[model samples]
Target: MLTAFLRVFAGEGHPVVLFLDDLQWSDAPTLELLRRLVTTES
Candidate 1:
């Protein structure tokens, strides 16, 4: 699911911008998904 979501922005001519807000209110699963994305992406 994450890979599919990321592929939406792959191989584009324009710049890709992501906006994440209200992380303080995010649930554990949501936060964990973000952690996984950051770790794998880096």
Candidate 2:
């Protein structure tokens, strides 16, 4: 679900701002993917 949303945001060429309300509650994989997304240069 998140991946699809991100894909659409990227497709639109708009900067995506994700507000993760609670990092502690997030799954490890989701955090990892978010890290990769921000660090990656497309």
Per-candidate TM-scores read 0.61, 0.53
Local distance difference test, each candidate: 0.73, 0.73
lDDT tens digits, residue span 1-42, model 2 = 556667666755577777777778889898898887777655
Per TM-score, the best of the predicted structures is 1
| Model 1, C-alpha of 14: deviation from truth (Å) | 7.0
What RMSD value applies to candidate 1?
2.8
Report the CA-based lDDT of candidate 2 relative to the real structure.
0.73
For residue 35, model 2's alpha carbon misses the true position, in angstroms, by 1.0
lDDT of 1 by residue, 14-33 (tens): 54566999888999999998
15, model 1: CA deviation in Å?
6.2
Clashing pairs in 2: none
Give model 2 RMSD, 1 decimal: 3.1
TM-score, structure 1 vs. true: 0.61
